[model samples]
Target: MGLLNRYAETLSELGSFVLPAPLKDMRVGLFNTTLANELALPEHLLQPQTMLDWLHSPVTPLTQQAFAQKYGGHQFGQWNPELGDGRGLLLAEVIDSNAQPHDLHLKGAGPTPYSRHADGRAVLRSTLREYIGAEALHYLGIPSSRSLCLFTSEDTVYRERPETGAMMIRTAPSHIRFGHFEYYFYASQKDKLQRLLDFTIEHHFAECKAATNPYAALLGAVVTRTARLVALWQTHGFVHGVMNTDNMSIHGITFDYGPFAFLDNYEPGAVFNHSDHQGRYAFNQQPGIALWNLNALAHAFSGHCSVDEIKAALSTFEPTFISQYQHLMLSRMGIETNEKEQSLAVMQSWLQILETNNLDYTYCFRQLALADINKAQCPFHDIFVSQENRFKQVTLVDQEKTDAWWESYRKLRLAREEETELLSLNPAVIPRTHLLQQAIELAEKGDFSLSESLLEATSTPYDARWDTHPFSKPPSSSTHTSLSCSS
Candidate 1:
């Protein structure tokens, strides 16, 4: 059979592969069958009903020609000479039911020539988080990697602790990172860099094939998509925690859900990753970081594209992000698009209040969708402490200053074509930090019920029914001060 035909059959079943000897000591775990169903893969492909069955199966993976891709990227602002699918391998590329080609990767399956010094085993905890978090992000309509399968084993691996071993089948449009190009350039491998660029354009940037300078066009496209993606993250109050070059995808999908969090309250400067002590990837700094990463990527392509052209393309990040964010925020406010300054002023003032007061970001906007805007009668107000103090503070502000802002906001509302329109733009519930922690805590005890419930709630975050769920609350003082970069 042709390679594509053989791949088609494997997609229908968990066809075996010969495990490279280097990976023999690594433990295995299988994902739930539900993952196969999500991918619309054939039923037989989902072997081993539980993760345990798949993990211990003596069956080996198919031995196919390795699809080792080459690319470059920036690491913490410095150029790296070498980085590829160091530990993981791309098993195959299959077209899903949606006709989208997805790369199936076996993370921690074994070490390759790229494995530096660490074992290629993944921890169960991190695997579980990626499994569910990827699914959650997909359902939330964010461009992200999809979790096709997850497996766990009794074997112990030590990171911070001796944890059970696990592996995950990660799916994405393309695993190509900005660092891929950086790797070649830093090695002075211009010919190899050109080959990588050709392959990328052929596989992912076909739309730009006709452009005079396809490499520059490819950079531009990545910049545009990434800007919009980060804007979506900002609007939803999500912090990716780690914005490393290798973690940034060329197609703009959010990947590497390590130390990630949904903000409990609207703190623009919120930092979720404990490792990010300097706050380089804080909530508000995400956009800036994104631009920085893109610039690094552009620098890699400097050989093929002029520095002036790259700078002009990079310039699009700010305006594109601001415009996209403003539009999304306006939709959440249920205000029709109006070119007037008043409409924009209302959004500014409301966000300022949210940030200044440390209000529950998701609830405040959700409550605004209701009939009552008054704090005392607002069910949403309960999410905040008694608003008396806040209200008094608002009153104490120079009446003139407050009145000017309020009048501008009111005028913006007056221009709103209708009040009911904004409801769809704002979501009533987000995967709040406290609730996710609770779910993780329960999952750690071998109870997945809360995790399942939280998943269901987050899947329909905009639904009013979510208001009854306790998972929507902000973390108390006792919650972990920072999230760890674990599964």
Candidate 2:
């Protein structure tokens, strides 16, 4: 037997209103049996037919309820009062082994109250991105929403072009976004806002409920989680592309993988989402943007908490993020964070080396993992031999700066270097956008094997065998592809 349905039982009490909507031609094209087993879905519900039916059936009997959640957000730093589930629906939540609720959300489930003058559908290109990207984050030991299964059909949607429809079952503890609280607060619905807050506290923030000031504790918990999450993203060179208040999860997971990218060449200012013209959500700006979003979320608590209380809670975000980021970066050099050698300055020097040389982020780190600790020379420079720098547009590297950083790293390594832990932290492979574009192109021409293969490869990304995989290599050209909102 798999998990039992409990979402419908507590759906109303949790403050999410149902907006029942039907989808067309929802046929299961691909099923992720691996994730199904991991999520521990009921044996009967694990089949593709059962998952397909439960997701699309209009008058559903087994765990069937279409709900479009309400949320308000600051899009590009402007208050967007009306933004909610447009192409997605929270179908149901299931009880796992420990009885924790995991939302069985259907992205690309079609139009609801939130679909404003647009077709509520997602294309296969983006579906595969989320499907593989979620699993990749998990393999990298980052906290994120998991993908259960993928479904595709003949349903067509208008994006940059006419595209085939696809949907993915995203698994998360709760689908309640930060914007959910903002939605009710902005609408002057104090009763609904309080109900939402109470429900959140009961289910997700139970620890906070026991605190002296439950509401303040809840905000503090979110701030800490978010800070750590962004720090992980920063060290891993992950650009989330979009950092809207609505896109930020209240539970602090790396959800909503749209136009996300890992570093191709070590450009701190790398912009992955083409739509983000201002570089507000660029690779380097993630830390600042996270704090900005947390500040925006703090405003929602104004009616419930005092100004002093809010300031105190929000104040911890920066130090927490910076400290965590330093520890992570220091660990990358095989230096134990608890030692005196673990300095943020050492990490910055390494970043400056990469920035000056314009090296491949993943490849350079991987080669450094194989470096001889006794050597003072730049060990990963060979990987960039005869290779052009994509960001700096040069074939020559700054040897002087690279040598200086190498000497510093060697000095730190002499004291306390744990190669095993460093290898564990830095991955040998990431779902490169160049390879992803190739896989998506192949899928467009009636071949899904590549996407399937990529998913499998990413599930164990640090495995040594992937070193020979074509995806392990960085792009050879400066013309790297950039994805947009549609992607």
Candidate 3:
């Protein structure tokens, strides 16, 4: 409950107070009833007129004076001090039934002092993309911000072209980022920077306060959570197209979804954000980039932590990430072994098979689990042999080589009981880019059937029923896989 309210007045210099701009013909396009119930939101607030009125003018204790946060970021490895909540506002903080506090953020609310020269509005397409992406990652057992509701308007917004303006209510443990501390630190406002750090620790990372050096403990906690988070992303083949420091959540959840995608084929070098021409945020580069961002954050904590302690905290990233990633990868393969070197070899060889054969990453893993449980229905070759025609650019995997790898894999495979664990670890569905575009196109035409259906599929990704659904397959032909950050 102390999110922004506890410091908005004291930290007025950190942000600006701005009410949401009224949108014409606002309609609730999608809502997360499950989340609403969990938050115990009153039924009246769920109504369109009442909610819209509250967004523009707050009267209930549920909300406070809305304000946009001020922060700066290192974008594409270059420090940019002008970035912040350009079109979003921290409307309020709500404590759910479980007493866990969550920030209620409204994206596309309106323009603010940080909007620069652009209109502070989000298109329906991008709004839905963020909405679907957050939920998809959350349901995949990954840490992520969750969507509360989406409201579309008749007001037109222009990006690459004209589109309907929309707003999404996003919920997260906290909206604080590494950039928040960076902004004050670089501005030479050490007092404000310390205040921000203490506030963040008090509300979010309270467990660190009991340590002899709370600041160093906070850094270590962030590093550990971030390592595990990015490791999960790699095991699931997720590509976070933009890894700017401003987009890095202090809570270590996948935050600021923009130009993000799941790997259709296991291409380690894949880049999904069109603006990333240099492939700085490529799929394979996420772990390195994460460490880089942590190093940038370490600069902000210099006043509170000694260089050696900060380095000690940062040094945990690599081993933590490797341990988490190795465990997840081996679990997906149903390989139960104490030999780390042998398991790493098995994992690398399996990845080579997928890359060499151009197999669908999701399908290959799901099929592997199925073959172990039901070999008659899901043969092992369904991934290697049957998918050869789909990929013409590369030759099929060498049969002799695959046979050798298969023999090595068989020796490490777990017992039959591990099949269920494998199936749960490997999802049968992800929010594929092609399918997301289709949902966006249809939603633009006021047909939300596809979007609704896609949300359901993503929210229950472990269900095998989706394997045969049209949404499960990758794009038949390469459509526009990259995206602009306009939204």
Which candidate number has the best TM-score? 3
Against the unseen true structure, what C-alpha lDDT does each candidate score? 0.66, 0.77, 0.84
- Per-residue accuracy of model 2 over 1-487 as CA lDDT, tens digit each: 3443343355453334344333456666567787676666778877978877665456563334566676788988999977888878777666666766788888876676777766777888898888888889988878899988777666777788888777788888888888888888888888878888887899888999888889999999999999999999988988889989888898889988999988877898889788888989988899999999999899889988899989999999999998888778777767644555445677777777677667788888887776887776776565555445444454576676677777877777776644345566678888888778787787766677888888888887878887777878778774546787883
How much is the lDDT of residue 128 in candidate 3?
Answer: 95
- How do all models score by TM-score? 0.84, 0.93, 0.95
Give candidates' CA RMSD values in order.
5.2, 2.5, 2.3
Residue lDDT tens for model 1, 300-411 = 7888889888987899999999889887877777554566465677778778766666666776777667534322232433434433243333422233443465455555
Better of 1 and 3 by lDDT: 3
Model 3 lDDT, full chain set? 0.84
**Model 3 — which ten-residue stretch has the worst lDDT?**
373-382
Better of 2 and 3 by lDDT: 3
Ranked by TM-score, top first: 3, 2, 1
- Candidate 3, which segments miss by more than 4 Å at Cα? 1-4, 7-10, 58-64, 373-378, 414-420, 478-480
| Order of quality (lDDT) | 3, 2, 1
Superposition error at 195 for model 2 (Å): 0.7
With candidate 1 superimposed using the best TM-score fit, by how many Å does residue 484's alpha carbon deviate from the native? Answer: 2.6
